[model samples]
Target: MLEIKDVAFGGKAVGRLEDGRVCFSPDALPGERVQVTVTRETKRFVEAQLDRVLEASPRRVKPPCPYYGACGGCSYQHAAYDYQVELKTKQVGDVLGRLGGIENPNVLEGVPSPLPYGYRNRITVHRHGGRIGFHRRDGKGLVDIEACLLASDEVNKRLAELRRERFHEGARVLREHASRMGFHQTNDGVGALLQDAVSEACGSGGCLIDAYCGDGFFAHRLAKKFQRVIGLEWNERSIAQARSVAHANESYIEGDVAARLAEVLEEADGAATTVILDPPSQGLDVQVADLLRAYPVAKIVYVSCNPATLARDLKSLAAVYELGSATPFDMFPQTAEVEVLAILRRRF
Candidate 1:
């Protein structure tokens, strides 16, 4: 029996074993005593399987999805939606402090998703051996599913149509609509909040350089705030789309960010320039970080999907930038994933 102390960043509850070794288990909540069987043992910690809940937490609730445990897509289904946000908010601060080495990180409350379930606009289901669904929790094989509760009605309708027919062994992506080819956030409502946060941080500037700006998602929205908005992207399709709807003041460049960012920064007004970085899960490239430090902008609004990588990059930029605020958005609720927006100001 172990007392679940805290829920880690990956939605796993952490506890200490009787032998003083740390133990991690899923499907367990903090403040609950659970009986677990050791599955894997390492020198530092042990992985366990939750056998029984000796004491359940008040935050625990019955998962609406029938395949909650079996499906690996949603981890916090058993946890209350509000509690999940709270945990995510705390996890951001914890990760920043632990990984970034920032003392007493100022992490604001997490912005919750309007619709906890049925919010995803897109999902990819794997078809293996005539089974069409997501991978199992253990990731060993695919679980045949009829409907996904997390997907929107439109997406679910497409999934139902795909299920009725037979397909070969491959992954089929089901989306509500045939949007332009590029990356888009699965949750629409929370994604707007994310954009608002980035926009608010950007405020008004002489020039806006949106790095990794896909289809001018933030650049176009924030174009009015600046005399000119320049967007940088690597995808030819995304750049074309961004230029198709480009405003008189907006210009998009297609190429590697590391290669083109320096020229964009050199041309922008250094005193009133603001750069919005919405990089991939890997965070900023080493060259990009070095460039931002070399050419300090007035402000940098960073949007990240992975906290660990965000924290790592923030630590690297501490010398040139001072963190103003770090806010998290529960863009992907009922899962371990979170989107954080950090605003940084150049240090004199």
Candidate 2:
């Protein structure tokens, strides 16, 4: 028996064994006394599965999604939405304080999604038998589903269409609404809020250079605030879309940000320029970090989906930059993924 003390970053909770060994138990909540079966053991800590919850937390709730526990998509559906936000905020502060080496970081309260359910604009469904749905939590098979509770109505309609018409065995299909197509934010409501947060912190600068600027999202939003706005992305399709509606003040470049960062920064003319970097889950490239060290951009607004990668990048940037604030946005409810925006200003 162990007492779960806190919520971890992933789908796990903190606990301690009788001998004072740190234990991480899954499918349990904080303040719960759980009987755990040890699944994995390391010198530093032990991993476990919740055999039974002898005591449950007040924050625990019945998951709304029928496929909550079986489907591989969601993790925190068992917890209340407000508790989910609190857990995420604490996780962000913990990661920054320990891994990022930022002591007593200014971590603000997490911003919750306007609509916790039916907000996802995209979902990947796999063919199971004659039907299409998500994979099982164990990854052994697929779970047939009629409609996902996390997708938008438009997306659900598209999913219905996809269910009626499809081909190939074990084929994975991405069904999306015709209007919101291809690699856009899944939670537009939360995205709009995140964009506003970034824009408010972006302060007045000579220019803005957007890196990993998918479809010129932030670039187009803050174009009016800067004299010049240039966005760099690796995807040709995204770049094409960005250029299709490019304004007189905006320029979209097709190339890796690390390879083309110098060219984009040249337009800044060594003045006060804000560099906006929204990298992928893998975080920044080594080339990008080295270049930033060499060039030392005056200001940076970094948006990331993976806290581990974000912490790693921030640790490197701390040498020449002063971290302002780190804010977490509960972009995805019932899931472990968290979106964070970090503000930085150069020390020199």
Model number with the top lDDT: 1
Best TM-score among the predictions, by candidate number: 1
| Candidate lDDT (C-alpha), each | 0.91, 0.85
Summing lDDT over every window of 10 consecutive residues in candidate 1, give the lowest-scoring window: 177-186
Those runs of model 2 whose alpha carbons end farther than 4 Å from true positions after fitting are 128-131, 170-176, 179-182
What does candidate 1's lDDT look like per residue over 1-348, in tens digits?
A: 999999999999999988899999998999999999999999999999899999999999999998888998988998999999999999999999999989999898899999999999999999998789999998889989999999999989998999888788899889886774787777989988888888888999599999999989889999888899999999989899999988899999999999999999887777789999999999999999999998999999999999999999999999989888899899888989999999989998
* Candidate 1 segments whose C-alpha is farther than 4 A from its true place: none
**Model 2 steric clash pairs:** none
TM-score of each: 0.98, 0.95
- Candidate 1 residue 333 Cα shift, in angstroms, is 0.9
